[model samples]
Target chain A: MRLELQGVSHRYGDERAVEEVSLGVEAGELVGLLGPSGCGKTTLVQAIAGHVRPTAGRVLLRGEDVTDDPPETRSVGVVFQRSTLFPHMTVRENVAYGLTRQGTDRITACLDLVALDEQRAAYPAELSGGQRRRAELARALAPRPDILLLDEPLSALDRTLRDRLRDEIARIQRETGVTTLFVTHDQTDAMALADRLVILEAGRIAGVDRPRELYHSPPTRFVASFLGRSNSLTATVVGVDPPAVALGDTRVTTPELSGTEDLEPGATVTCHVRPEHIVLSNTGGATPADTGFPDSLRNAEEKLLTLAGEVTRVTDVGHHYDVTVQSETGTALLVETATAPPPPGASVTLGVARDSLTVFD
Target chain B: MNWTRDSRSGYSLERLLPVLLGGLVLVYFAVPFLAFFTRTGVDGVVSGLSTPEARRAIRNSLLTAPVSTAVATLLGVPLGYLLARSSFRGKRLVEAVVVLPLVVPPLVGGTMILTAVGRFTPVGSAAYSVGVPLTDSLVGVVLAQTFVAAPFVIVTARAGFGAVDERLEQASRSLGHGPLATFWHVSLPLAGRAILAGVVLTFARAIGEFGATRIVAYTPQTAPTRIGVEYRRAGIDAVVPLALALLVVTLVVLMTVLRLGQTPGVDPP
Candidate 1:
């Protein structure tokens, strides 16, 4: 079943909460709605679940118009950020609450899916935070709804619990094969769980792509800044032939922009590349004072653009080092390194390839 | 001196002031009830219980008060839910109207009811012609008690329903339960304590109602009305036993209701 929204827009009084937004999710595909807080991801999910009515749009479930259908008729199973398990009821009864006639077989199956079969007789208050979330998941899943809506389901749990439960949800979602829409503000959670991520900005779609694609090729400034740790710097086009842009005192080549032959020189553009792509090496030959047209990046002839900087700070983050370098342009670029980073005040060379950059006007 | 903390155990002068004041107030309140046992011995209570008028009033109050309480709960629970959940224009005004009965004097409410359904009025006459008179009958007593006591249910149940997270309702709805079913299954059960509190308060108010009961249906005397009648015909000494009997009955009922409300996770017997 394909779920689609066409030009969905919702307003709270005169203030718009969700603008003309449209997206589609295929059957059994887990698509994540990712954004910062107050970006209308929840509102969009609500519209799909029929909890909220879009001021102007159509919601189609499997090519059938369900725009006017109430939430009860929409067959959407939702696990809210907070536990919605009926407190007076035991875990088994909570799971079977939506089963129309207290059917126990489906309830047992759903509880087994969340690994909560042993705690069936316990009330919601007796369960831990993660256990309560699992119970809520069982309750929502027992009904076998057409669509499953998870809204920040593991957000309230601790870090270790959140990771474990997020993985659990992903597994359950795959096994159930229900068309699931997971909404979260956590980029890491979205990347880890979603097959595709829809990044929203101020109630509109910023970008929609697979997590890796969006991570490497964010189309907008918001998406670039939101998806991961990226250093954004202003670049002015200094050459059109082979497409080279000036980065502070050095000229860095950008070879990946499509139709770049016609891009005029002196055009101010914004370019961003992830911290891992920015290669920070100890300044062995070129000092901060040593300036040249084409700087040496580890003495390689591969023409990788290099900039001179001094290491400002270094912090080991288990698998990598977060080396903060202050370049001549007064921009602080974060570079991730597997090797031991130089101490503060050591001059370093930051190199990046032409194809690793994302340039936009 | 530590204002909130006391060094002595149960015999400090610091605690004695508030205790003394509380004692004075308690004495002021409890002296009248204390007089019930002192003034009326077991013989008087048994004699009062044996009186035909007192027995009739007790039976009448027991019947009518429960009817009004049941009716109030049936109507007030939904109204409380609506008030707690949704926002519309004049919501504050609607709330004020609902709670007006609690704020206004019961005598004033009784007078208002009397004017609306006093035999000559259109509704009153139509009911009277149809042999369903609203005045000087048990139905009239119930109507008066419902007006005064129903607000207790609305106010407490509103607090209960308000405590329910809206997300729970949304989750229930998304789970294929309509609004009514969601209320019964999710909202009502989650807010049972508050709803039960409201019903208990309504029961207390309805059973003890006197001013409105007198104006609407004085002939079908409730417990309070009988006490008043006995006081006027005889004296306070004669009515102490009846008041004591009413108190015992109310205490037993209140205790049962509170016990039932607290019995969570246990199957209904």
Candidate 2:
């Protein structure tokens, strides 16, 4: 079923929790609402589930207006962060609870769907964290809701279990073709599980796009920083071409920015460069002077703008070395390096390719 | 550091204090009842039991107490649920009013009821028209007992309902159960223990009620009233056996009810 929210707003006294937010979820599509704590992601989901009546706006379920309907009449299934299985009931009983309420047969089939048929006789206390989460899922799915709402469903599990169940939940969503809305604070989860991601910030939609597009070309600095680690540099735009931007002694070009026509001659802009895009040079052969890059350095200088500093720390973190470089400008930059990492107090020049730098106006 | 010996000593002392205090209090209360039983003996107790007045009092106590408890449970449980779950203007005031009976002197409560249900009032006149007299009747005793005891049930049941997770109820609602079904299936079962505890407490309170019964309906002569009458007419010696019998019966019932409360899964037993 397609779920559409139109101008949904909510308030707790003077503080607005959600404000004029509107979004849609297509049938068989899993859309994730990603935001930080107190960002109203959960509030929006609650509104959709009819738990919270929106102060304004309407909720549409497959073209039917269910704005004023009570939660029990909405027929939407929800799996909460805390596994809300009835504590006194066994796993089987908890899973069958919704089904029995609907007077449906084949309760065992629902248990089998979440792979909890064996643990059905076990109480919630006896079940492992992942097992309990699975049981909660079974309970939610047993009713065959038109829309499934998951509010940080995998957050309570440990890392390994969270990763396992996240994949399991995605798989289940695909198999059942349930129109699903998942809310989570983890960006990795949103990117991995959601076909489309809606990034919310301060009770409003910051951006909404496909996962790949959102990661590759984030619309705002907030989206860019929230999605992954990016080195931000403040500079004034000196010149602009279709695909190339010239900033105070530095110019970077990217094909993704080729169609931009709004760049002016002199304007303050923020530059975003992923840590992986910066190439560390021992011989300084790939410096801006030699490679036609707009900016160049005389040596590893001790200034903030200069990507030149002594390595204060070097710790190998399995896949990458977490390198902390301190400059004379009193600014420190945390860089992730996968290649040869310098030992502590070692000097190295950092080279950033032009195409790898993203300039945001 | 000799930690093991110190720990053992501390644990033993912690265990001993409550046991010693509890045993002392038990003997203090049990001695008089025991004295009454022994002085009357099995033959005297049997002879006391054969009295028509004793039989009527026993029937009155049995008949009135359970009926009062039932009335309290029927009215109090739903009121408790509402108090716990809903938010409204003057909710705290409402709660205070419900529990007013608990703090009001039992005689004062009986007087309040008498004024409200006596022949001078609308309720009393309606009851008189229907040939139902609440004053000096068994029904009056039951009503007085219920008034004094209902607050116990309401308070316990409110706590029970409050202990239930609202999320679970919402989850049930989302699963297609209506409001009433959700209450029946999720809310009540989860709060069952608290409700059972409330029932036992209300029953005990109603059975032991003396002041209200005395003021409202002294004619039917429930056990407590009868014991009071015997004490007045023939001194403590004359009423000791009946008092002892009532005390023994109430203690057994209370212990059984408490055991039921402590039972796992089903709320006591």
Candidate 3:
């Protein structure tokens, strides 16, 4: 592990800020600590940076115990959420500050990565918001630390600037191949920048996996709901014949249920599938492309498992329409489509892929 | 900007109130200087300035005030940073003690200094035993000046240090600079304007200081003290020219400091 936290817990007085959290980042990997505000991501980063000492556990950098080392000896590069550019110094001086070599212009070399070498002579006050952020990044990069920590670097930026900076960060990480930890509450930013996402909830690690895997096959209910729009159903197993569960209308069975260990007959389980996986249509379209009728049909013509539902609402979200389908038992689900969805009261079929359904016992 | 709105509704008696209040305050502040300059002719001012007593006092004030201010800065700046950045027990009490000189009258400060370091006291007796006298000396003036003016440095520098973003120091640390290096390279430079303002205020206040100096160093009369002595002997007319000269010198120092403080990067908070 390039940077590792082993059961690192921190407390301020009696309030437990961070619990027993353990995670590691491999060399040349970009891992994102994704969580909402007050989730202790910032405190964890501070502990890693040696600003806040952990009340319990050890911090290791490159397999060396650096738990007692101060930030200067730790040799970690950090880009705080706010641009902490030394406003009194020019961009060049700010970047050159970390380099101990005398009479060397390493400032230009670092600024080259952020593409702000041209603005090297400008003061921090003179630069735009994005320029300052880039300059700060350049300063942090100048020292060439093995581990880089970025705390919500793009949160303060506009969407367009964020996209640009996010891509720049990804490109820079690739070029440097430095083990990096990016902290952010925005899932999209984390998804765009990180090689792996560490989702945190209430100061504990909820899940850690590659971005796409976490989005699609979340192991926990929180992970599933948090990753994206989810349509979850609570049902009890009616029978183990082909592994079927009694949902609102029919005993829905998927081949993926075989992988479920505690999913015996009569077991209560929650099954969640993403909104995008669900297909809604009036006709009996049974395939992945064809959405079946909105009715409780146990046996379909194509032997496909379908659910009875009505189109409750259609919301236009710029590029697409979010079609919400509610089952007869008031279990609501969403389906996104580029085309307009059928109006409310129109019957639609909620399609589910065998692989998309994630059951939690 | 919007003339129609101003004519229709904005130009009311309420709007006239602020202007009237501001004009009255401005006139009140300006009237003394206006009268002083108008009363004293150029030749009379020059004649007053040409006096050996005036020259000596001016020279003494010029020599002593800056040294006092420098001493204040050297001691106060670090203390200010500590006050702003660090937490200690009874911090409120410490802060109050730091601002005590600012609140106390200059005469009271001089008397307080006398009580603590008078020839009869151990502090003064020890210094006297070392061949240095506390009262009726150039050093005495500086000591009195510093006591009254040091609070300005600490107050302004504290504010300046407080205004500096803590994240800047954190970033410096993450970039491998230690605490001292970070303070020198980032914190000090960022807080330069406020510290310079403090130093300037200290110098100005020190130069114009009188009641304390009169008690501590009556021999080496500063410009303000000299003006007081002249006012008693020959009345207001005798001291106005010297007062104008002192004011001109103060303005020059202020303008120079203002220019120096206005560096390219030192933007006002």
Candidate 3 residue pairs that clash: none
Task: Please give the RMSD to the true structure for each candidate, in Å.
Answer: 3.1, 3.9, 3.6
Candidate 1 chain B, run of 10 with poorest lDDT: B260-269
User: In candidate 2, what are the lDDT values of residues B152-210, reduced to their tens digit?
Assistant: 99999999999998888888889888889989888887898889888988998998899
DockQ comparison, 2 vs 3, better candidate: 3
Docking class of 2: medium
* Candidate 2 chain A weakest lDDT stretch, 10 residues: A297-306
**Where does candidate 1 chain A have its weakest 10-residue lDDT segment?**
A285-294
What is the per-residue lDDT of model 3 for residues A230-290, given as tens digits with 9 covering 90 to 100?
8888877866666667676556665555346656687788888887776566763433345
Specify the CAPRI tier of model 3: medium
Candidates 1 and 2 compared by TM-score, better number = 1
Check candidate 2 and list the clashing pairs: B260-B268, B260-B269, B261-B268, B262-B268, B263-B268
lDDT of 2 by residue, A1-361 (tens): 3899999999988999998898989988999999999999888988988889999999999889999999887879999888678877777778778775533355687777788888878778788899888888888888889999999998877899999999999889978888899999998899999999999989988899999888878888788888877877665555564445544444545444422357666666676777776655443333434422234433322111235556788778899887876633334556787876778787665655555566677
lDDT of 1 by residue, B1-269 (tens): 54564655655666688899999999998987676568878888899789888889889988998999999999999999999998999999999999898888888888889899988899999999999999999999999999999999998889999998888888888878899999988889778888898998899999999988888888789999999998999887888777887788888988998886773553242
Model 1 accuracy (lDDT, Cα):
0.86
Best by DockQ: 3
